[model samples]
Target: MIRGRITGSVVSTRKLINLVGSKFMEVEYLRGGVSESLIAVDLVGAGIGEEVLVVTGSSSLRALEKDAPADAVIVGIID
Candidate 1:
């Protein structure tokens, strides 16, 4: 899992059927001295500015609904 903060959100009205009901958020992760953000499907409810845990690849795919087509997923929010 990767640690990141919720930066924004994504709205897709024409996404795949499997992903239609899922909420997507932008999360920023630090790499070296720089930080980058990516869109992650929300597995847990996370608000902007909140620290969260992200899962990617096969683990993310398995954590979501069957055949969710998610490359990344926000699994948890940190206090």
Candidate 2:
């Protein structure tokens, strides 16, 4: 899992069937106190300004499906 802060929300009027109802958020990836500013999909409900944990790769695919074509997914919210 990776740690990051939610910066904004992503909007797509048209998306894949699997992603039809899913939400995506822009996350500023943080490491060593620096931000990478990456965007990720949100399977769980997370809001801007909130710290979040993200999952990727096959593990993420297992959680949501690899065929979904998502690079990242918000797995949890951190206080």
Candidate 3:
């Protein structure tokens, strides 16, 4: 898992069948106090500027496979 802050959102009209109804957000990856923005899938309802936890690899794949193609999935919203 990785810790990050939601930075923005992604909107796609033409996507794979699995990804039609999924929400995507851009997260600023964080380590300590530093961060770098990257894209992630939002299965959980996360808004921009919220802190969140992300899952990658097989865990991410499984979560994304539920509704869309996900390489990185938001697993939790952090307070």
Candidate 4:
């Protein structure tokens, strides 16, 4: 799992059928103290600037449907 902050949101008019109802968020994570960003499927409703826990790879897909085609997913929102 990776800890990151929700930097923004992604607007998609069309996406894969499995991802139709999923919300997407832009997350900013630190790597070697340098910031990097990635779009993650939001399983937990996280707002902009909120801290969140993210899962990647197969774990991310498991967090959603059987095969969500997602590389990242927001699993938790930090208080």
What local distance difference test score does each model get? Answer: 0.89, 0.82, 0.82, 0.89
TM-score per candidate: 0.93, 0.80, 0.82, 0.91
> Stretches of candidate 2 above 4 Å error?
32-34, 65-67
Ordered by TM-score, highest first, the candidates read 1, 4, 3, 2
Highest TM-score: which candidate? Answer: 1
After aligning candidate 4 to the native by TM-score, how far in Å is the CA of 49 from where it should be?
1.1
Q: Write the per-residue lDDT of candidate 3 for residues 1-79, one digit (tens) a residue.
A: 8888898998989988877778889988866767677788887898998989999766787765655566788989987
**Residue 32 alpha-carbon offset, candidate 1, angstroms:** 1.3
The prediction achieving the highest lDDT against the true structure is: 1
lDDT of 2: 0.82
Higher-scoring candidate on lDDT, 1 or 2: 1
Backbone clashes per model, in order?
0, 0, 2, 0
Clashing pairs in 2: none
lDDT of 2 by residue, 23-46 (tens): 789888867877687678887789
What is the Cα-based lDDT of residue 73 in candidate 3?
87
Off by over 4 Å in 4: none
Q: Which consecutive 10 residues in model 2 have the weakest lDDT in total?
A: 58-67
TM-score of 3: 0.82
